[model samples]
Target chain A: MITKSIMIVGVGGQGTLLTSRILGGIMQEAGYDVKLSEVHGMAQRGGSVVTFVRYGEMVAEPIVEEGQADVLIAFERLEALRYAHFLKKDGVLIVNDWRIDPITVVTGAAEYPENIIDELGRKHKVYAIDAMKEALALGNSKTFNVIVLGAAAKHMDFAKEDWLKVIEKTVPSKTVEINQKAFLVGYES
Target chain B: MAEKKIMLGNEAIARGAYEAGVKVSAAYPGTPSTEISESIVKYDEVYAEWSPNEKVAMEVAIGASISGVRAMASMKHVGVNVASDPLYTASYTGVGRGLVLVAADDPGLYSSQNEQDTRCVARAAQVPVLEPSDSQEAKDFMKFAFEMSEKYDTPVIVRTTTRLSHSQGMVVLEERQEVPDKPYERNIGKFVMMPGMAKGRHVYVEKRMEAMSEDGGGFFVNRAEYRDTSIGFITSGIPYQYVREVFPEASVLKLGMVNPLPRKMIEEFASKVDKLYIFEELEPVIEEQVKSWGIEAAGKEIFTRQGEYSANMLRRILLSEEVTEAQAAQVPARPPILCPGCPHRSVFSVLKKLKIHAAGDIGCYTLGAVAPLSVIDTTICMGASISSLHGMEMAKGKEYVKNWVAVIGDSTFMHTGVNSLMNTVYNQGTGTVIIVDNSTTGMTGHQDHAATGKTLKGKTVPAISIYHFCKAIGIEHVVEVDAFDLPLLEKVIQEETERDEVSVIITKAPCVLLKGNHFPDVCVPVPEKCKKCGACLKPGCPALTKKEDGSIAIDATMCNGCGLCMQLCPFDAIAKEPK
Candidate 1:
C-alpha cells in the first residue's frame, strides 16, 4: 500500500481547511483510508496555517513529517517557501503566485523574498499559478483555493469528474457554478 | 450496521458522548476543546451549553451528574486550572451517574499560554485519565470513560492533546444507547465533603486507585503488541502513533488508560523486551512511575519533555538516523494578527497614542502587544490585567499608574475580570480599566458568551451590559464609547485615568470578523492628497498598507472599512470607497 502525504500551506482564512476537506473527501470516496490534520485557534488569525492529508490503504498518523510530503499545495508564495522542507526532494510543488506580506515584512523587520517562485522552481518540480487572478476572473476571489486545488487535482490520480462532484457537495449551492468554473481555470492553468 | 465517516477528534468525542447516552454537556470555548461541545449540541438527546468559564462549566456538568444523568464538560488544559477546584472535590464526592471531563492539552503551546499536561492534574486529583491516539479511539474511549466513571463511582478525565483533538480520522459511528438514569439519592456522607466525610472518601479514593491499577493490566484498552520483542515502546495518546510510525516492527505497549499506570502490563512488556523506551509527550508521568516500580525505562532523557513529537523525531532518537534537515529560511515571521478591521485595533491605537502602558488580558486584544501598537505591558492570564494594574499602583505608587490602564476583552472581562475589578473596588485601588467590548469571544472563533445576548443553542437572551454591570459593581464613573470614535475614546481614556477613583471605559464595537457584522464601508486612500506620514499604519490594520510610492492603499476585498485608518490619517487623505 503506497501512502501519499499532501501538505496544504497558506495563511489563515485562505480556505486551506476546506481544500484539505475536499481532498480528504475525494480520497475517502475513492475508498482510500484518509486522515487530515489541521491547526485551529490562534493560527487562524492570519498566521501561517498548514493542513496535512494522508491517504492510502491505511494512515497511522495525520501529520506529514519533514521531507515526507509527496505534494505541497501552497496558497501563497511565501507560505510555499516557508513549508518547502515538508516537501520531498522529488515532491510536486503547486504554488499560487500570490504574496501576502507577513507582519515582519510590513513592519520592515524583514524583506519579502522577490524571487521565491524562481528559487523553488530551480530545485523542485514547481507549478506556479496566479490562483487569485483566476478566481477574480471567475468573479469571486474566495474561489482561489478551489482553483489551487483544481491545479493540484491535475497532478493527483483522481478523475476530473470526481473532483467536480466533490466540489459540488463541498461548496455552497449558490456558488457551485462559479466554483466549478474556477476549478477548471485552475486545472487548465 | 454502523456508519463510517471521517471526523475530527473533537467531533468524534461529541459523537461518543451522544452514543454513550450522555444527558448534559457543557464547556467554555477554548482551542482544541471548543468543538467537542459545539458538535455535541447537534444531538437533541443531549442538552449542551457554553458556560461562561471552565469552572462554571465543570460545576454545571457536576450538577447534571448529581441529578442522576450522565454529564460531560470540556475545556483546554489551562481551563482545567479554573475547573480544578470542583474537579478535586468531585473526585472525593464521586458522582450519582457517570461524569467525564475532557481536558484538551496543548503540548506545543500552539494556541495556548502554556504547555501543561492534563495527566498530571488527573494524577493529583486521583481521577482515572483516558488518552486516545486517533479519532476512532477518541470516540471509543469517551464511551469507555463514562463506563469507567460509573463503575468506579468517580469523575473520569479524558485527556487529549492538540494533535489528537484537531486531527481528522475515520470513525465507525454507532447508535445512541439509551442508558437509564439512576435515581438521585441524597446521602450526606457520600455526597457532601465535610472534613470528616472527605477523610473517609480520600481513603476510598486510594482504594479505588489500587483496584483500578490492578485491573488495568487485563483491560483491553491497556494492551501489549509484541512483534520483534527486541525494542519495546511504551506510549499513549498521539505519541503512540509516532512510535508506531517510526518503529513498525518494534513491540509497543500502548496504554489507553494513562492514569493508574497498568502496572502489571508494563511489567510484562518490560520483561519480554530487551530494550524498553517510554514515548510520552510533555511530562514524564509514566517514566517516573515505571522507575518508581523498579523498572528501568528510557523516556524524557532521550526525547525532550517539550513541544510535540513527530515520526522523524522518534526515528532520530531510537535508531540514531540522520533525519533530513531542511535549510532554515530567513523568511519573515507571520505571527497571528488582529483581523483587518478588528475593534481592538482602535483601542490599542489610542493607548499607543497616549503612550499609556496598558496591562493586557488574553483574547484577540492580546494582539495589541504586537508591532506598530505595542501598548500592552503584561498579559499574565485571563483576568490578570486588572489585578496586575492594581499591583503596579501598589508597588510603584499612585503616580506611576497615571499613565497606565488595564485593557481586557468583553468576554475575558466577564470570564474573571469582574472579580479582579471587585477586588479593586473593595481595596479602594485606583486604576483605570478599559474593556474592549467586541460583542463576542473573538479569540476562540467568536463563540457566543453571556454578554453576547445569545445562548449555545442560538437562542436570543437578555444581554448583560458591561457598562451597567461595572457601575453596579461600585465603579462610580463608568463610561461607554464606540471604539471607532478615536477622539471620544482618547478623551474618555485620558479623563478616566486622571480621576482618582477606579473607572471603566467600555469601548463598544462588534468584531468585524463576526458573520453578518461588517461596516459596509471600506476606506480607500485618495492618492492625490496622500502624504505618507505613516500615521494610518500605526494601528497595523492588515487592510491598510503603504505602497512603494509612499502612498497608502487599501485592499478593498480585505477591508471592512471600519474607518479606523481614515480617523488616524493626519490629512483628509482617506475616505469610504463607494459601493
Candidate 2:
C-alpha cells in the first residue's frame, strides 16, 4: 500500500497531542504500520506545533515532508495557512476555522492573515469547520479537535464504529461519551 | 505473529531497558530524554528517579553499576555536557554489570538552546554509541548496547536524536530477560581514578577502543542493505529513515553503533557502490573518519551539518531536483510564551517595570527575554544566571550589578542555581537572585523536582524549601513573595537588589498547569472604566488584546485570571471576575 501521510498543525496547548494520540490509535486499530513524529517541551508553550503521521504497508520516514501530506488537519486558520504548502496537490485540508493570535501579532510584530480558509480554498480543496463553536454548542469546547477529526474522517478509510471504538479507548473513560458524540457531529457533517 | 504495539521511541527504549533487566535508572528532566525515565518508572521491577542534575544522575547510575547491577542514565545533549565529567571516567572504569546511557541529541535545535551532537561528545569520551532508527530498533539496539557495554568492558551510549526519541512506531513486545547481577569486586586500580591508576586504565581504554573497532562489524547492529549498487549511503539513527524514504532500493551501510567506525563494513559497502555518501545529522563524525581512512565519501559538503535532514533534502541535493511546491505563507511566528497565568509573567512584569535586566537561566522564565517584558538580558545554560550576575558584580563592582537580578526557576535553582548562590555567598558578591519558584519544573512539561516535594514515582517526600536553601547558603536577606502580588514582588526585588550583600527573593507560585492549581477567577474587562491606556498590554500577554476601538479586552478562555493586567491597569478597567 502506498504510504498515507497526515499532518496535524495547531498552536501548542490546543490539544494537538491528544488529537495525534487519537489519530495514532485509529491507525493502529486499522492494523497499518504507522509512524508518528511529535514535538514536545518548548514548542508546547503556546507556539506553533505540528505532528506528522504516516502509515502504510511499510512506512519509512516518520516525518511527512513538504508536499507529501495526504491530509492536513489544522486546528487554527493561521496555522493552516502556514502549513498549506505541506499538503499534496489533491490533499484534503481540514481546518478548525479558529484564530488564536500569535505572540508576534500580540506584540504587533506581524499582522494575522485575513480570510485564511478562503485563501487556502483558492488553491486547494478546503473543509473548514467552526469546531470550537460547535464544541461550545455541545457544552464542551475541548472536544473541538475530535470534531475536526470527524470532519476529516469522511476522507479516511476507517469506519464509524471503528473510529468510535478508538475514540473511546483513547480519551479518558469519563470523556468517552462526549468525545464519541463530538466525533459523530463532525463525521456526519 | 508477535504482539506488536505502537510506542514512542523513548518508550521503546524504556521497554528495552526493562527487557535488558536494568535494575536502577536515574535522569534529570530534559526534552527528548525525559520520557525515557518517565516510561521506565512504570515498571515495578525497575527503580527510577529524577536526579537533580545530569552529573548526579550519571554518578547514580555509575554507583549502581559499581554495586553490581545493570543501570542507566538518560539526558538531553546539553545534559551530556553536565554528565561528561563522570561519563569520561566511566568509559575507563567500565561497568560492574552493564551500564548504558541514553544521550538524546537535538540536531534541529527543536527544543534546545544549541544543536549539539552527542556522538561528538561520545567520541571525545572514547565511548561506543549506538544509534537506533525506529522504535523497534530503539528497543532492540538498547538491549544490544547493554550487551556491548559488558562485552567491551566499557561504558556504552545509545545516541538518539529528537526525531528518533519523539517519534512513535510499531514495536514488538518482548518478555524481560533477567540478567544476573555481577558481584562487586575491589579493583582499586579500576574504580579509583587516581592519576597513576588512571594512567594504567587509560592504556586499557585505548586497547578497548581497538577491540571495539575490530569487532564492530560483527555486532548485529551494523548491517549492510544491498540493493542498487549505483549509490550507497552510510547513515544511522533517524536519518536512515530519510534515506529509505528517498532511495528505497539504494544500498545502505546502516551503522547502529556510530562511535567506532566499522572499517571492514564500510570498505565492503564502498567497493560495491559506484558512488558513496555519508548521511548523518549534525557533526561529520563518521564522514571525517571514513575520509581519513583514504576513502572518499561526500558529506557535509552538499549536505548541511545543521538542523534535521529530510527526504525532500535528499531529493533536492542528490537528484538536484527543485521542488515546485508552493512557498509557505509568510505568517506571524508563534513563538512559545509563558502561559496566560504563568507566574513568570508576574515576576518579569515587575522586573520590566523597574527597568531591571535579569540574567536568566533555563526554564519558562527564559521567555521573559522576549519582547514586551524583555527583562532578561542573558541566558547561558542552567544555573548560569546567579553566577553570571556575580561575575558582572565582580567585573563592574557591586553597584554595576544592582541594575541586574538573577532569575531562575525553582527546579533549575535546585539543579545548580543553589551552588551558584552558594558561590556568591562564599565570594562575597552582591546580587539579587530571584528564585521564580513555580513549585514544579516548567518548560519541560511540569515534572516534579526536589523542591516540589514529590518523586518521579509519585511518592510523597519532604519538599526542599528554596527560601530555607537560600538562608542555609548564608544569604542574609532571603525572602519569599507571592508572584501574583506584583507590588510585593517589585518591592522585594528592589529591596534585595539595593542591598550590598547577596540576597534572594523567592517569588512563590505554583505553575498554572500544575495539578491542583485552581484559577477560579478570570480577568474580565470593564470597557467603560478603560481610558485607552496600554498599561495592561505592556507585558504582551496573548490573552489581552486591544479592540478596534482601542479598549483592552481579555479573552475569558485565554485569560487565566492572572490579574497582572488588573494590577497594571491604572483606571481599574480590568477586574478579576469569578469564573
Candidate 3:
C-alpha cells in the first residue's frame, strides 16, 4: 500500500481546485482511495491557495504535513517557492514559470524574490514550464491550469488516456479540444 | 448494493439528512457549512431555506420539529453564538420529532474570525454531540445523530471542522428512509418553557443524560479498538485519523459520541492499556472529563490547544522528531484582497480620501483595513461597527466622531446591523452609518440573503430596500449613492458628517464577482500620457501593477474597467479599452 501526496500551490482563481478534482478523479479511476482537501471562503480573494490530494490503498488524513509531499505541482513560481518545504527530500517539483505579485509586493511592503527556479532547482528535481505561455498559444489563458496538470501527469503512474478522459468529463464540452491540446503541450514540455 | 461516490463532508451531511427523511432544513450561509444546505436543497422532498440569520434559522427548524416533523439547522461555529439563546431553551423543552444541529467548527481559523470549539457549547447546552472524522462518518454520524435525538428526545449536534467539512472522500450512498412524521400533540408542559414547566423539564433532561451515559457504551457509534494495549489513545473526530496515521499500532478508543461519555467503556479501556493519552483538537473537553473521573491522562500538555493537530504534530510529540523547516527564499505575503472591481474598493477609496476613521464589520468589506486603502480603525465582530461607532461618539463628544463613519455590508446590515442602527436613533446619537450594499453575501460565496430578493431555491421575492428600511427606522436623512461614483460618495460623506442628526448612506453596487455583473470594458494604460506618479496605485487594485520600467500596466485579464484607477490618475493615463 504505497501512499503518495501531491500538493497543488497557486493563487486563487487559477483553477487549482479544478485541477485537484481532475487529479482525484483519475486516481479514483485507478482504483486507489483518494482524499482531496482545500481551503475556501476568505482565502479565495486573490490569496495564496494550496490543495492536498493523497491517494493509496487507504489514506488516513487528507492533509499533507511539511516535508511529506511526494510531488509539488505549483501553478506559479513564487507559490512554488513558498510551499517547497512540503515536498520530500527526493520529491519532483513541477512549477509553472509564471508570477503573480502578492499584495505586499504591489504595496511596496516587500519584494518578490528573484531566481526562484534556480534556487528550487539546486535542491529538488525541478521541472519549470511556461504553462501560461503555452495556454495562451492554445488560444485560451484559462486553460493554464490544465497545462500545469498535464505537465504533472507525466510524473504520475496513471495512463495518458485516463487523464484525457477525466479532463473531458471535468471540463465543458465546447473547450475540450483546446484543453486537450494545452494538456499535450504541457506534458511534452 | 449501495454505490460509493466521492463527496465532500458537507455534501455527505446533506445526503445523510436526505436519507434520514428530513422534512425541513434551514441555515444561514457561512463557510464550510453553507454548502450543506445548498446541497440539501437539490432534494425536492426536503423544504430547505436560507434564513436571514442563524437565530432565525434555528427557530424555523425548531418550529418544524415541534410540528412533529424531522428538521435540521446548520451554521458555522460563530453563528452558533447568534443561535445560542434558542438552542439553550430548545434543550429544556425537548424536541417533538428528531432534530439535529450542524455546527461546522473552524479549527485553524482558515476562513473564520475566530477558532472556536463547538463541543464546549454542546456540553454547556447539555446536548449530545457526534463528531465525524471523514466523509463516511460525516454521513453515518448524521443519521446516528437524528436517531439519538429521537431516542433521547433532545436536539442532537453533529460537530465538524473545516478539514472534514471541505475535504472530499468516498461515501457509501443509501436510499432515503421515509420515516412518517409523529402525531402533533398540544402538550404545553413539554413544548412550552415557562418557569413552572421549565423546572420539571430540567429534571427530565438530567434523567435523560443519566440514561444516555449508562447506555451509551452499547451504542454502535462509540467503539473501543484494542490492538497493542501497551499505549492506548482516546480520540474522536478528525484527530482520530491523525493519531491512527501517526501511530497505527497503538490501540484507540474512537468515541463518535463526543459528549455524554460511556463511563464503563472508558474504565475498561483504561485498565487494558498501560498508558492512556487523549488526542483531541482545539479543546480538552474529553481529556478534562476523563481526568475528572480520577483517571490520569496526557493531552493538552503534549499538544497545544491553539491550532489544529496533524500526523506530523503527533509524530513530533511522541518520537521527539525535529520538524524540518524549509530554507527557501523569502516570499512576499499574499494576504487576501478585494477583487479587481469590488464595490467595497470604491467605498474604502472615498473613506481614505476623506481621512475618515471607519469602524468595520465582517464580510468582504473587512479587506478595506488592509494596505493602500487602510481606512478601518476597528473590527470586533459582526454588527459591532454601528454600535461601536455610537459608543465612541458618546464617549468622546460628537466633535470627535465628525470624521468617523461605521461601514457594514448589506447581508451583515440585515444580520444584526438593523438593531444597531435603531439604537442610534433611539439614543439620539449623531454618527454616520454606511451600508456597502453589494446585493449578496459576498464573503461566503454570494449566497442569497433577505435583501437579495431571492429564496434559497432560486425563487424570486420582493427585495428589501435598505434606504427605505433606514428611513422607516426613524432615521431622518437617508441617502443612496453609487459606490463607484467617487465624487458623489465623497460629497455625501462630507455632507452627512456636517449635519447634526443621524444619517445612513447606502452604497448600491452589485459585487463584481456576481455572474453577468462585470463591466464589459477593460481598462488599459495609455503609454504616451503616462507619468511615473504612483497615484493610480493608491486603491491597491490587484489588476493595476507597476512594470519593471516603473510605468503602471493593467492586466487586461484582471481588469473590469471600473475606471477607479483612471479617476485617481492625475495624468489621465488610464482609459477604458473597448472589448
Q: DockQ winner among the candidates?
A: 2
Ranking by DockQ: 2, 3, 1
Give Cα distance to truth, residue B218, candidate 2, Å: 1.1
What's the lDDT of the predicted structure labeled candidate 3?
Answer: 0.91
Model 3 chain B worst lDDT run, 10 consecutive residues: B322-331
Candidate 1 residue runs with Cα over 4 Å from true position: none
Lowest summed lDDT over 10 consecutive residues: which window, candidate 2 chain B?
B319-328
Clashes of each: 0, 0, 0
* Candidate 3 local lDDT, B193-301, one digit each (tens): 8999999999999888888889889988898998999999999998898988988899999999888888889989999999999999998999999999999789998
Q: Write the per-residue lDDT of candidate 3 for residues A62-163, one digit (tens) a residue.
A: 899898899999999899999998899999999999888888999999988999999999999999999877877887888888899889899999888888
Candidate 1, TM-score vs. the true structure? Answer: 0.99
Error of 2 at B561 (Å): 1.2
Task: Estimate, for each residue in B1-579, the C-alpha lDDT of model 1 and write its tens digit.
Answer: 567899999999999999999999999999979989889999889999988899999999999999999999999999999999999999998998899999999988889889999999999999999999999999999999999999999999999889999999999989999899898888899888999999999999999999899999877788899999989999999888888787889999999998989898889899999999998999899999999999988988888988988898987877788777676466888999988888888888888889999999998788888797799878888899999999988898888898999999889988889999999999888899999899998878889998999989889999998888988978899999998899999899999898888999998889888889967788888888888898888778777777898888788768888888888888989999664
TM-score of chain A, model number 2: 0.98
Q: Tell me each candidate's RMSD, in Å, in order.
A: 1.1, 1.0, 1.2
The per-model lDDT (C-alpha) reads 0.90, 0.91, 0.91
Per-residue lDDT, model 1, residue B320, is 89
